[model samples]
Target chain A: MTDALKPGATIGILGGGQLGRMLSVAASRLGFKTHIFDPGANPPAGQVADQVTTAGYEDSAALLAFANAVDVVTYEFENIPTAALDIIESHGPIRPSREALRISQDRLTEKTFLQSLDLHIAPFADITDAASLEAALAEIGTPAILKTRRFGYDGKGQARIMSPDQADEALNAMAGAPSVLEGFVNFSHEVSVIAARGITGEVACYDPGENVHRDGILHTTTVPARLSASQRMDAVLLAAKVLNALDYVGVLGVELFVTPQGLVVNEIAPRVHNSGHWTQNGCAVDQFEQHIRAVAGWPLGDGQRHSDVVMENLIGDDMDRLPELAKERDCALHLYGKAEAKPGRKMAHVNRITRPQK
Target chain B: MTDALKPGATIGILGGGQLGRMLSVAASRLGFKTHIFDPGANPPAGQVADQVTTAGYEDSAALLAFANAVDVVTYEFENIPTAALDIIESHGPIRPSREALRISQDRLTEKTFLQSLDLHIAPFADITDAASLEAALAEIGTPAILKTRRFGYDGKGQARIMSPDQADEALNAMAGAPSVLEGFVNFSHEVSVIAARGITGEVACYDPGENVHRDGILHTTTVPARLSASQRMDAVLLAAKVLNALDYVGVLGVELFVTPQGLVVNEIAPRVHNSGHWTQNGCAVDQFEQHIRAVAGWPLGDGQRHSDVVMENLIGDDMDRLPELAKERDCALHLYGKAEAKPGRKMAHVNRITRPQK
Candidate 1:
């Protein structure tokens, strides 16, 4: 049984970062070897995986060689170059499908898809120029945020138009890239639903966790979040519906805006998200394992929460506290091997878990 | 502060096996590189570790190069060859110290050391030959187990001697190796205490987990084990006492046999033990992260268990069940990428978590 696919099965990972590193670790735990493909020098994921392929996403020869070496392909980030996916898909199975990738890569398409499904999302309008910006601004209103439809992450590629006077500057900041202007949600708190779907159409969801952000980056996520039981149920149901609609495979993180009105969908990340880090410490199945199971065409395990959990990011230089942190009776500390501690970069995270109330 | 130790910081691993593979994963998580010194060609640890040095225990030149390349040294097994330790110590730090490894390599020495520290161990005696085996049998009676003095794992290097007539066969079975004759323990249950001590001597412990074994190999470990609060305290205290007495650094596993009378020291694993797998799925601070913390000279994190948990291993053909296991909502499955699944060999494991009663 092992000879056909017993763990030495190489899994090709696209993009190299902390998420990929964690995923490689999860895959290795289940007997699968990971082959990391990333252009970045010394990708964090490359440090631990069985092999590393350092080539640009545009290199077809490198992509084909990587694909030939793996049984299946998965990714950590969504903004992967389309050419890379094309070459890899030509050689191996790609989870969640290229359609999911294309749709998620474009905000305009994502919003349209959600609206078509009759799902809840903030009101939005596309802007191509000064006329489009002025028209979209009038329709979506002031105090709205302007975001490029592609390549946005960790507070990058977006600016807020607090008033009409700043709209021109915001529009010029994008340098003429197609953009979307969205009205802000008046939500009391932020939360995320991390769910995984298998190729067999099986779907599994973690209990939604309340997330707190600082300077537009996730700071912490706490499980058994302060939500009514009905609210939690509603969140899970909405996430399952989205995964079903996309015919998705692998882990998908749905960031939600919880308002007095109810749970409204904000955005969906086709890959793992920071908000799900609590699973690493709080549940039997961390997001990394869940994603591997989904893409491996294996049956999913129980995602039940056994305790109240809190996961906090250790950004920048806070990694210095690892010694003291390690002394705690129940703490899980993970540090990404990023050499540079630039401001706003996520360095690591710690999860503090408590016994679930009986 | 990670800059203090660049990406190539050489990590020295003592024992070479799957545990080393997992530790290599954790080390890569923090950007530290590792050099594994193992004598076997097919070491599970070497498959993933960055570098491998295959040489005899007494190979001085190989040991010198290994020490010179590594910034710090850690190990995977307790029974490291004493000569190997002498060589590593001459070049760099040999974690857990030679004394700990020397004492732990022999059952009688370990028991004696425990007794000297006011700790308790199962009744045991040193058996040098057939005559000594007869004497031990006469004194300790039938059903006593004889184990080799060093280099034993799983069910290897141990035999249960039940009849006086079988003394010669048992001694022969030991291959003339120095052995320990241990009286069978009348235990109600089995458990383990996993903890880490940093270079600064700060220690952290996860809650003890009840363990079950089949064929002398670990089967499952469940957290929030059925033990009184005081009993848990005793387990932690016992582990700390052993660590301090040995002046051990890095991760250690102290297995205990739980009996009606009280706790008895089963054995001490100088490195990470299989029983600590529950931490990977059910606790915030897992054993792998803690080991990394100790070796990195960094502060330790909290080792809290957040869920009531069950960890099940994948043996031989069990790797085929991974897809099904992934569909469970909170199942954490780990497969060690062994190329072969020969009978009784560890292939992988899964963890299932139950939420606390709210």
Candidate 2:
């Protein structure tokens, strides 16, 4: 096992979004300085990070400098190019590992990996061409989603196949990119487990949080998700199994579909997830800090939920409600410091604590 | 009253110490950016702030540039020179106001201000010279403390007068600086209330926290301090009175002595105090965020303590315990990203929750 980092170590973060911003804040709380490396100028994370390098992923010189300046490297998002990882890993260690990223980046690979572990997942088939798409639809049937194998987020790069007649249109929507046809699960509700694994192989999982989505975007996540005691234990155990199988060393968000049969594994994010944002107000140690601790090789903190919280994302024009939200009692606001409030863009979020029955 | 600031506004912070570092983090959470101005290079606040100006307060050009870059100006320390404020105020509004600083910066003025509010305060006399010192000693009697009128912190520039024979020695310790001779209060313990005043004149106060001192430095602050219901109300009321009197526009830390008669005001800090560190873990909105909200003209948040917390400061060599502390459950650590852990320096702190009887 790698030795834990001492205080005052510099942590290199490869992303400059809200996740990176919150992670930098958490790293600072642990006496670790963060250097944010992103191509975007004045990114949200750069506003709070100790240092910022506005350079592209292919900039080998910049990447080398960033790697040499920090004790460890971690990414806020999972879509980092393999070329970038090849350069970053040469100078320092990267937590959560490249293998986790490789599998999660491709929907086909992720499904195959989960199925290999005997984990219950939705019926899926790879579609690399028109012939393959038709064959997959014949097997998966109607009511399936055709999603691109990589670089898909927030409902983008996806099309629903409602009937066999629409297969041609759905295939056309793939735009020649490799895709995966996933049979829909009749889930009563969706839930996510934010789990962490330390370098020493210890694992911890937060209680599952029920999630509600609108327009394929997350709207709200409520902690203490409605789950049977046994189901809760099952969700945690499944998440631990994934983390251990990958030899992960950071926080991972495992999305699941809760059906009458049991919990079906949907996908896994190799970094802190939006559904886990409620932990910032509901637990003693939040997911951002938990991720930082794990990546720094420190012991994972307690993930027990101390308060019931409902976290709502402020997307698109939600910036107009800031005046009222700022005045709400028991509400904690977390703004991403984005310059513009573009449509579907996540500008901020608020976590309202409803528990302890205060 | 000034209009409330919207998100995305820039706040200029003076003195880039740990308090400023925390305040910067809070500002970022509210979708606001912070610019830290300090003479020291690579200050703790600079690690989290969006901008850093390494210039002395007396550097007029740099001070004006900083003020112009931000929507408003606030400070983490009370010892800013009057001349610097003159230049800064010309560019942007300064929160807590210059009046609040003038009163809190000097021990003599702080005592007089509390007395003016009809609040209980220890008897004090101004000491400008040897004759004044001797006369003040006669009036206050032995067992008094001779402290510098300004720029004193952490028990520095303070001399104990245990007997009449030590008067000359104590007076010599002042070294020609203006001083205050305060008669000792026979109090059971010390407590502090972290209070906030919004731009609209709204006031809020956190529950008092009892403090313990070791070597004239704060060791720990425990929330839900031992107090009767009435005494707690009194503490809150006294803190509000101080804030309202000054028309303060940020968080203030009011130290009090719980004497047999009633609560005696010891002094006031214009910004968040070390004693209020427990709020970061015990309250939904911490003192740092509370200060940010007030200065931003947002509504005051609920200051009610939700959990019982013991905030212990990691001073100097106490850094050695961080490894063990990191493994302790229910502990939230806040470290100041300082490079050195010099003697008597506050390197970090931990708030251990003893709440919900877990």
Candidate 3:
């Protein structure tokens, strides 16, 4: 509004994984310094960040110091502790708002919020105990997933029920935490809209990308998604509706199911999403930069993609293919400098420019 | 020949200015960490680098320590002191080779090296004193430039002569340093090839970019430069010739003059050049990443240009236009977080995607 944060302004980030690492690089590209706060030592983001605080979220003094040093605060992941937000928010502004985090952090709350906007979502019910779980399963039927309401990602903290008989095991997987029962939607495939809203209430949405998951992990995302003009419009419009409804001031990822009847909402992530990584090569401004621009109050890029790209994640042993991938034509690699190649860990991603769609 | 530097490998970089800053970001994208060695405190590159050794190049102990900490060493500036390079090279390999640096650090050596490669270069003579300057003037004639043999950049350490009578003033401009006298080429415009050579002898050259200067500093570099198809091939071939001749293992900038007869060599930079910044948006693999790949013993990118881009530098007061530029469509900004906007200091650059060429 009043001239975006000046070039030297420092941005405080709450998580220091691959997302935080990328956000740090993006901040630098725009002349903004980033100070990363994470409990882990030698966080991936710390390698590229201007400053880093290796302290837990419960360390209020560290949180306060970090907030004081940065002009504004944003985050890489949505599961930030409420108390940490309270401490940091007291010193400086946090983009995307605490309200956005509150909703996305809990599955029940997110689905309810989306439904309130008249957006179609998978039928879901809350579960508090054994009886509640049984009742929800009875109503939602089999072929459902039971997920913990919070602290879940990359298919963690969830269990699938093939039939009503498996409801007990699924509920047990929750470990007695409050949960949500989501009846599987009959959808052809999954797609996601990476969207952003600026401080001036203007919204921009990148074209939806078709997603393919392997073993509950994102395998690849291809732009020029298989979508009719109406489907693309629906995806972008619904993403904008969610952004405006939350008064969001940063990028968000909205995953959807391309069902036979219409598009159905799967979930929303309040920060840059892995599904949007193709934008690093496909668009003039990537999701990380767009998030930084919105949080800094700069004008959003028009979100017009210049190239068609296929982004494939390099998980764990995929690092073995570095030699082959490096030799491949038109492949731009974005590797997270994680030391260990533990199974299922995301080591890097490669975005191959297929061609310019235009 | 072998695998590229592993993701967690550290790359030691000399000269922590904007070039090192960009190189650091590119290394991070490939999952490598960078340690910057700069004399200045809080260098722009330090903000993004994993480590910073704020020690002057003359500090042999610091230079040795920096080199010992990384897998290999590379530099951002060509004017590194011979003693400092000796210290670092004794500890680890220095890419682009010490020979490449030796040739490029001095204007006289660079010209001689290019001529040895059978490349077309401007007529030049080494100048050590008034007699030599006068003799060179007689041979080269008026409208020539006298440039210091070493440590000159951005048109500094040079003086122009329009007539023979101005010889004394031009010689005095050198202030007793070794100098070179060059006859100005009657050319139409300037263009540069951003070229790279891998450790295994593979070479890649980006399409030549037309360069326009303002106050003797690069103003903008536009890809798809005005060149006949044959001229374009000449540019790339000559660039590859230079790279292979030097056994270069990193990116080089080869400036050329478009003349009525043919393309003439203007100058060569052993490291990344400001004129090549357009490749960041125009090519699948940018010059920075290409340089890293070369030095790390990786295969070279195909150097394919997907979009037409114009890269404009933001010098000093040009930072004032950030607000306006931020709002422009297809504009991708890369800003250096220098605290003060000193006159002539390069503060940032913007790459505007003109359109896809194919």
- Cα lDDT tens digits, model 2, B44-105, are 99999999999998899999899899999999999999999999999879998999999989
Candidate 3 per-residue lDDT, tens place, A1-358, comes to 4857988999999999999999999999999999999999999999999999999999999998999999999999998899999999999899989999999999999999999999999999989988987888888888999999999889999999998888888888889899999998999999999999999999999999999999889999999899999999999999999999999999999999999899999999999999999999998899999999999999999899999999999999999999899999999999999999999999999999999855
Estimate TM-scores for all models. Answer: 0.91, 0.98, 0.99
What TM-score, to 2 decimals, does candidate 3 have?
0.99
List per-model TM-scores for chain B: 0.92, 0.98, 0.99
lDDT of 2 by residue, A217-237 (tens): 999999889999999999999
Per-residue lDDT over B1-358 for candidate 3, one digit per residue giving the tens place of the 0 to 100 score: 3556777899999989999999999999888999999999999999999999999878988988898999999999998999999998888899989999999999999999999999999889999999998999999997999999999999999999999899899988889999999998999999999999998888899999999999989999998899999999999999999988888899999999999999999999999899989988887789999998988888889889989999999999999998999999999999988999999999999999999865
DockQ list for all candidates: 0.54, 0.63, 0.81
Assign candidate 1 its CAPRI class: medium
Per-residue lDDT for A219-273 in model 1, tens only?
9898877788998988888888889998998899999998898988889999888
| Model 2 lDDT, residue A43, Cα | 92
**DockQ of candidate model 1:** 0.54
Output the worst ten-in-a-row residue range by lDDT, candidate 2 chain A.
Answer: A349-358
List where candidate 2 sits over 4 angstroms from the true fold.
B356-358
Error of 1 at A215 (Å): 2.1
Candidate No. with top lDDT: 3
Top candidate on DockQ is 3
Clashes of each: 54, 0, 0
Candidate 3 error regions (>4 Å) = A1-3, B1-3
